[model samples]
Target: MPKKHLPDPEKYELGEPYTHLGIPFPRLPATFEKNSVPLKEDYKMRSMDYLDTPEAYSLFEKQADLIIENGWKGIIDVGCRHGPVVDILMDKGYTDFNYMGFDTSAQPIEYAQETWQEFDNIEYRVMSWNEFAPAGASKGHKQLGQNNKKETDEEWWSRAGVKFKVDFHVDVMIWSGVLLYEPTYHLWFFHNMHNAYGAQNAIIQEPLKDQRAECWREDLELNTIEHRLHMYKTKYYEYESWEFDLDIFSGRRIISRVKLWQDGDSKWEDWVDTHGQLAANPHTEILPSGYKVIPYIFRGKLNFELSQRDQTLCQVALEKMFKERHSHRLADNYSRDKLHLGKMYMYNFVFDGDEPVFCSGVQNVTDKVVRVFSRYFAFEKYKTDGTTLLEKNDNFEELQYAMHWIRDRIIFWSRDKSPKFFERLKVKNELFSEWTVHPTKINIIYPNNEQYIFYTPKVPAEWWKNGNYDGFFK
Candidate 1:
């Protein structure tokens, strides 16, 4: 897939936050001297152009909906660039949320603080995950400190004037497009968020590269034994090429419910035993601090019943299709269990006799979009020697049928404008693409420097028409 074209960052001058095509976008400060914090080498400054993209707005709206649906009062957005998430949430009438935006880059956080100073409930902090040390190592030892005075969690929040009514627990932790660069501390960060901070859930979006062991054969051999062991320990699951890695950005987003265990906890031993089986070598050695990091699992996709009466046949056909198209080695992983955690969905096409003729598996990405993985036909051609031969290209019709079914039923927003299976579906006019207006409203803008109108399908009209979107204020 070709990468989506974005405005050049060099074209914009560094100054105060200004309107670009009528959208209020934060400007990158000329220097970081004011904050006395140098930018990290891995911190790549992003342009406000991303706000205009469909993916960005869709994710923002969806997350805000999730926050509201779960009744989560406090949210900590990690790597919040210029506080776009906060801005969107506030615009959606969530002013009561206890929102804290944190980022390693000082300039963005500084800009966010200045931009959102009017909101008493919102706070922006220039801090890295590595530097964050929560008050308590365990639930029993919870404590907070201020002005050289040690206080309990409640006393600290009360004295500090934080608006949260409950105990100091972050309901949700968001890491949007920031975890890929910090791969080394990804698991540790998740661990800390669940155990130290009071994050019950997390929304993590990262660039999904092909990090499978087979693909990293050469890289694995070149790395030190210790590094290889660590890689195997963490990323043990084998991923098929078609399972993910679809677009130019190659993004994989996951919303997970965090589960944590301490040494004394009843579930701690069970978790350790599971890890031992998954790890390279099982050993009796345990951490002296009793801090254990468990792997995160994505919430499963919502299951919708199909009209096909013979469900077992459909399952069998899907398994055969997986073996043929995807890796034969990882065929078992493509089964029911793998369907959870953003794996794949099997759509069966049954003909007149209630016979399953074709099946295609697609990955349901955040209920926003779907990516087709494998399309297969159940038919086999007989050769001159009376041997059966399975041809690949015979499933185009079935593929088209499945794609249309997904587009009409499951997908609210489509990444592909000109999909192979579907005709040209009209998106929003370019003039209305600016982020200044509410996602539901149609607002257009024309910048002075640009020749063509700047617009995007941030929120697809079809979604609203089909009653698919139930976001904030709706």
Candidate 2:
């Protein structure tokens, strides 16, 4: 089982320290100075594990294509561990461009420098963009050491064997998987890029808190409750692309495209209020609007299980069902033989005779309710005539059956013998109502007239006598 939280430095072995802004930070194992080549199993920067993934490779390919198509001359890859971006570009047969890579880690920088030593146009530095003082800052204040003589930013760049000016012109800048480490420095980093580098276009990618919810592994051996809390609290949402103005005085503007939890209203004001405070120099005016907020719904646990034979039949049905719709793919979690039966989950299924007509994988959410991930429905068969087997009303019936199944399972799962009632059940998507899945004749619980409606299902008095674990059916 994968660990539930980040490995503890004290308990587990760590790589060599990498300095950034004169401050030492630990690198991941296998990327240490001692390791000449990163281990294949290591998912850290040394082996460029991220790029090896199918999704990441596709993304990088597209990014590389974009850079080539634009005919960019000079490229600066911030946080360019092992110079993967340069390697990708070179592999694509683009060698005329000047490339400068920056990273806080000394190991990766050293590795990159040695690997690409033959290429004089390419350069790697064991430094962060944050190390450079903003344009016009005092030379003495920006000096690294007390013993060494003070030097201006230009002089420092010159001494470091690089010709960097206040207007450090670069055609394109790439910052991938860097911002998440220091989200507070977002504004400052952009400001510096615009002021000193005269950066025209910047491609940035960061893990958002909302989208990262599903990435959590529950199997980890957590040392502390705090680690669990941290895992639960982290949210991954969206990445932003920036366009810097050529003229420095005009400043730069960023347009952010955010992914919401469930198509809810964008919490731009909330983000601005929170993130703005952390900014080195907050730009309240630049924050854009009209972005939608993704809704986060509570997914109750699956209270029932099926026999292995029944499970196989259900899986086949689900695959066919999805094929008929041509909508969703069968997720690995559902198709896998092993199942993780736990609290806080939800599942959907419709049966025609002994075989399932439709099924949705059990959905799970973290305790913090920040992340939610689930597999889609699978069908057993598709209509050759290109018509759906179930009509609108039939679909409604199936949904009703599924809901009743949920209610019964919930009732059985509850310890209380009396009729159980819920204050409200909220769904952001209108499809829930369109599919006629919304429960009717339910009381309006909230005074504010919210979307959620009350539900009270009566359970038989004798139902509790059988005990909660009464197999899959009532």
Candidate 1 local lDDT, 102-205, one digit each (tens): 77776666556666666666777766554333333223333222233445645544543233122234666776666554444455555544433435456554
Cα displacement (Å) at residue 396, model 2: 78
Query: How do all models score by TM-score?
Result: 0.34, 0.34
The per-prediction tally of clashing pairs is: 4, 31
Pick the lDDT winner. 1
Candidate 2 lDDT, tens digit per residue, 1-474? Answer: 211123243332334434323222223343345432222212344234324333345445555766787787767777877666676787788777878887777766666676777776777877655445433443334432323556664455555323332112366677665544433444455544532443445565443222121222222221112112122123323333433321111112222222212222123211111111111111011112211111111134322233355455545554554345534332444433422334224444444455444443323222211111134333435223325322331333333333322322222111111221221111432323222222323222123322222222223234434342212211
lDDT of 2 at 17: 38
